[model samples]
Target: MSTSPRLKTQDTKARDAEYQALWQACDRASRKQEYLCSHHEAKRIILESACHGILDKRRGQGKIMCGTSIVSMVHLHLQRDVNSRLLAEARMSRFPSPPPNDMPCLANPVANAGNPVGYNDIPQQQQQPQRVSPMISAAEMALRNEVTSLRQDVSLLRQEHELVVSSLQILTERVAKLEGRQAVLEAYPNQGIEGRNAWMLVKPMSPRSQTQGRDEDMVNKAADF
Candidate 1:
């Protein structure tokens, strides 16, 4: 359940490494490009590499990758690489430079006006930009996606549980109604002596008593008429 997405089958791992190398090359080649240009080039490189494996200039042609699975894996890796790069660049841009060392109290003010302090003249140390690794970025993305999937599963389970509980409640109420009806039927004979007699008549009779009862009822009816 906790397997890393990076640790795939042996062949898959090999292909993934190859793809990473290709993307890294692309990253280096496009470093001087503008944001949108770099992004588009990265995408193009990824698609080309995924479709037609890594190219070997010495060999003069691209080796074809075997399946869509490998291509898709490379696509994800490329996206992570791009994201990590963008994040690193953003971090680098966000940090403000330390203030220039208070211009050495020059005894002579005439020296400052000749060359308005160029950035190169600043002796202050520049903060080094923190780098975010692609692997770390990939792991973070994987964890986020996993969490989202789990939340969806939990929501579905809750809905199913509620449905089951409602069904059970309906069955329980139906059973209670049936039991009440049965109790009413059971109490029918307690109404009066006439009810008791009616219940006795309603009860099942043996074959001989059935014939005798039918004959007695007909005789009584004929006499009354």
Candidate 2:
């Protein structure tokens, strides 16, 4: 059956949309990860700068206690910022929202807690036997029997073919021997010449004359020749 072109186009479009959405989500996640890394780096640099500034101030004041306290506070703040950004990133990575409670799980048809559409309530469809005419059934059985007979006939034919091939091989050998004998006879110059002369001498005679002449004289002439 032919499919509707429009429907096929729509289906393709839907699949493309789904793929595009997935790709976009992946791109966004990647960018977010990059941004988080950059932010973390920048925060570290800022914390380092704060510590260095505090140390320089302590050197001018000749008091290390205040510098240490300020630096520790700055480090604590940087740690808090890093943790918060990590938490935000984790939350953002939770993508393509989970399936709805009403949706069924295609993978596991036998419903569990994950699938709300329970298999228990679904009615089982009983398959009915297809009706067949008695004549048709008889015809089918006859055809099957005929096919079986044909198979046997084919096997017999194969055996016959093998026998025929063997016979041909024997015949070929016999023909080869006969041809060799004929060649040897032809190769005998005297015999070939005498045979040709006899044929030439009798070939011109009429059928009746040839028969009539086949007596003592003809025999004596043949012996002489």
Q: Write the per-residue lDDT of candidate 2 for residues 1-225, one digit (tens) a residue.
A: 888999788767755554443333322322332323446556455555544554455467754232134344445665665686688567555554443354333545554777665544433354555444333343464456556556767998999999999999999999999999999977654411345455445243344445444565776788898
Q: Give lDDT for model 2.
A: 0.54
Count of residue pairs whose backbone atoms collide, per candidate: 0, 0
Model 2 residue-pair collision total: 0
**CA deviation > 4 Å runs, candidate 1:** 1-89, 92-135, 186-225
| TM-score of model number 1 | 0.32
- TM-score of every prediction relative to native: 0.32, 0.24
What is model 1's C-alpha RMSD? 18.7
What is candidate 1's CA lDDT for residue 212? 53
Query: In candidate 1, where is summed lDDT lowest over 10 consecutive residues?
Result: 27-36
Q: Any residue pairs clashing in model 1, and if so which?
A: none
